[model samples]
Target: MEVRSAPSLLPILRSRQQGEVLTYLMCDPDRETSMSELAHRVGVPLSSVHREVERAEAAGIITSRRSGNTRFVRADTDSPYYDSLSDLLVKAFGPPHVLAEALEGVEGIEAAYVYGSWAARLHGVAGRRPVNDIDVLVLGEPDRAELYEALGGVEGRLGRPVNVVIRDAGWLRDGSGSFHATVTERPVVAIEIKKQLGRDPVPQSS
Candidate 1:
């Protein structure tokens, strides 16, 4: 089930703006957001966001309400496709979404990060080459088999092999080590798993 790269969500979605809009709203279903907020987060014009919101509402994908001068919108959890769409969005953008979902409920994952070439591009690595595999640096003592089983879904979604390197607090503490030095020196995409707060968060190096 290994893949070479992440799959594009554009084909299934109406446009890039639509995908962004879905990712934002779907990621935080409980939170209600305003048109301006959605526009800002999606990096699209207010008009475009408004149109997309309207379309989504008509399709019963989103629900809207008015609070005086501002209108608030939230995903319709009751929608028939709610779970399905949520899964699709997560798999479509595996870095955080899929990775986060996979790591959920796993035993001992402290903090996880996406490193190497894929992370480099996300960190705006200039002239970065395409990534054929995803390099994940996991911290803590989670079972290796369990971790791989979790990431198996992500491998299919991203169309790339997920090469995971497990490390405990001891390895993370050794700043002198080559692996630690390289990850600390480069861009790393943190996987924010709320339950596994094993230690203080490691700030990504700028």
Candidate 2:
């Protein structure tokens, strides 16, 4: 799995840091986070997070309240742009973020990628309809019970169910038949999981 920043989210929010800030606040609307916490989660400077949070406040996209010396911020549901931006952020960053967080440190996972409608939308494919469910393709045999438990957090965050398909490593490595072909042809967002160690999840053409 490649460790990379989400450049796809930049155009939607005009800044990756801002998008991340929004993700933390809006993904779980009830939860309030401080600028310092956002900075840590977003892997950016505290000053940058402060600037984005202030900008969001000015735009009425989010609201901040003080608790003693600490201030916590959350999305302003009253703002008309709140729902739309939340949906966009969920689509752009939700699955990848969820997958990485949930599946990290879980054993027997070689690789993971998001496919189907959600992935199509992520890549900006023309005519891709609204995504109602997330489709995840997981390589290596993981315990079904544990995997489902992990995915529960993702479902809650995205407000949709996650449909995960587990496959054997050899099945993909051998380039077996139509399923492999379809996965290779379509738009796929590779998930950077901490436990993955194997061949490329995506197949190369002959």
- RMSD of every prediction: 7.1, 6.7
lDDT of each: 0.72, 0.74
lDDT of 1: 0.72
**Which lDDT tens digits does candidate 1 get at residues 34-104?**
99988885567888889889998999989999999999999899999787786666444446656877888
- What RMSD does model 1 have? 7.1
Instruction: Write down the TM-score for model 1.
Output: 0.62
Tens-digit lDDT track of model 2 for 1-206: 11124444335356556676777677767877887887786667887778888998999999999989998888999899998888878766677776887999578888888887766654545442456788888888788889888987678767678998888776555766787777777788777785665556464221
Tell me the TM-score of each prediction against the true structure: 0.62, 0.59
| Top of the candidates by lDDT | 2
Worst 10 residues of 1 by lDDT: 1-10
The per-residue C-alpha lDDT of model 1 at residue 137 equals: 84
